[model samples]
Target: MKRIEPLSAARRGVPRWLRRALGPVLLIALWHLVSITGVLPQEVLAGPSVVLTSAAKLVATGELQQAMWVSLGRALAGLAIGGTIGVSLAVLSGLSRLGEDLIDATVQMLRTVPNVALIPLLIIWLGIGEAPKIALIALGTAFPLYLNVYAGIRNVDASLIEAGRTLNLSRSAMIRHIILPGALPSALVGLRYSLGIAWLALVFGEQINATAGIGYLMANAREFFQTDVIVVCLAVYAFLGLAVDFIVRTLERIFLSWRPAFSGT
Candidate 1:
């Protein structure tokens, strides 16, 4: 049998941050080369420089700021609503087999359904206002949270539960001290997943009759054939997703510090 070193061990000489950035650095270099080579029409696929220039213009005019705030508000609002419901249901299901049996089947069914597919029905029921958009984001975010949270809770070590019972800890005390802490890592994983889906859902929701949002900006730019503006909108979406992931990762490092596996060291 051949021996294979772990990637971290194999790359021990490389700085972790530099290694992490290698792919993106290469991708950008390739993009710049393609743009300079004129292999792709500039009008059809604007380069990073052109997109950055357009972003600067939009920022100077405050159009990007206004659209971003509206989109941010919608995303956050949906996340709050969906997150609350998800955590509550997950806790309920975690606390009892009866609760799990009652709620899990419906969640599993709905989780399989695409949130984007609900747009038409949501629009019909909630009208073309912010309600449908928020609803769509909520639907998209809820399932990831539920699945991860339920799994985290259910997977808590049985030995820990027995130890808590030996210590004669009350139900609430056991849950608070043992289960939630054990599940924190998985729950944070769910949070990261949900954040990504929230943005995806927001994009889908805003595409439908949106007057303000990154999606709306992209839609308007398409009408005027402004490739640069379209590229700017996509760049903004990418940046936002990265930002959300960073925040959640930071939270994990902080909250899961007690666990050596997750510690910042």
Candidate 2:
């Protein structure tokens, strides 16, 4: 009888990176096959190969890089502004009932209104300038981050806080040593969500009277019926969102290393 290999041993032969890429590889293969099969019209949906070619051409011309940089700047600026405000508000509210009463209700009410809906008013007030676009991204990113950070702080163990008190820790010391560390995991979770929302907001905000950015490129492509260009812009958006999420995950691994939950990584 032929010797049977252990599953774990067999799996060890596959590179981890390859395993991670398997899903996307399969997806691209399926997409290519579908394109060749003509299940959808080429005008409606360009194949992965066509998108790749379009992306290469755009890159060679430096158009994609310039557009990407413009979009990236908008997204990052919005994220920085929104994240700062979110964390600040969350810290205040999480630390005191008075702050919660003052800030939480207004934030909650505003949360009910979609950020995209604010575009019209933003345009009217801020015009088609970069201000409205950045503001829209900020508005879209803030609430999720605020909610997450607040929840994380609130969810920190009472036992930990009490233990800090037992050690005669000062209020500020307790927050710095215990509360912040305990709340970090949740905050990172919020960061990941906020990054996703920032990208989404960028996509929406950039479409409005945009002269430079991935969304503008997509809009321009749509006007001329350049399906491949539109697809390339979409791929860039997807990649940027994924890249930000990966960065957040890296931060989590670095900061959350003390936790038992992350010991495996």
Candidate 3:
């Protein structure tokens, strides 16, 4: 009799839950081993226990909460501004060739330049304060929103537009009835993507000019060899990302309830 392959059997027969659990189990074990071995510098990367202790200290003092609020506020404000402007421009561009040509090249050029490269110029212009940080966040988020919205609008089914025209629907009515729904799913995807970039930009901004917030905490800790504080900062950053993503997922479900595929998942 031919021998069956062990690898194929494991791959096919193992439960997904077990597979997922195994990854984290292996990662934690590796992390524990690395911490014990001192391969990575203790100052740069503390073990789990040190991170947790730092977290507890920051929590009791309310420093953690304040940093979260500062970072979150910046990100949310940028999202609102960028999302609104991107959607508005996308609508205009979709309706008119003149708008499309005018808006397209300029946005494309701006998107190519890294946001961090603009920091020096921003500091010179807006000063080393909140304005530059907020502006950076907005800049980071705007392009993704703009690109996704514009693409979604442009790719709206030609047949649908023709059908609306055949039925003698006005331009506004056709856009409202047909175009909006088709394009909205993509817009939602862009919104989620932009929010992630906004968080990253906000963290980078804080690391530079700010005296407070998690990024600043990390930056300062690095200067003083306080690895535990650095670990706390990273934990806070990761936790916030998870919390924001959960909120976005919830919003996606509620707002896009009409999407049957998502509902099934």
Which of the numbered candidates is closest to the native, going by highest lDDT? Answer: 2
Better model by lDDT, 1 or 3? 1
The residue pairs found clashing in candidate 2 are none
C-alpha RMSD of each candidate structure in angstroms:
4.6, 4.0, 5.9
RMSD of candidate 3 to the truth, in angstroms, is 5.9
Top candidate by TM-score: 2
How well does each candidate superpose onto the true structure, as a TM-score?
Answer: 0.92, 0.93, 0.86
C-alpha lDDT score of every prediction, in listed order: 0.90, 0.91, 0.83
Candidate 3 has an lDDT of 0.83
How big is the positional error of residue 220 in model 3, measured in Å on the Cα after superposition?
1.4
- Between prediction 2 and prediction 3, which has the larger TM-score? 2
Residues 1-265 of candidate 1: C-alpha lDDT, one tens digit per residue: 9899766677578788998899988998898889989987798788878878899999999999998889989999999999989988998988799999999998898889878778889999999999999999888888889989999999999999999999999999999999999988899999999999999898899988999999999999999999999988888888888988999999988998888772232
In the range 131-169, model 2's lDDT, one tens digit per residue, is 999999888888888998899899999999999999999
Please give, for residues 128-199, the per-residue lDDT of candidate 3 as tens digits.
888888888888888888888888888999999999999999988988898988898788888888888988
lDDT of 1 at 239: 85
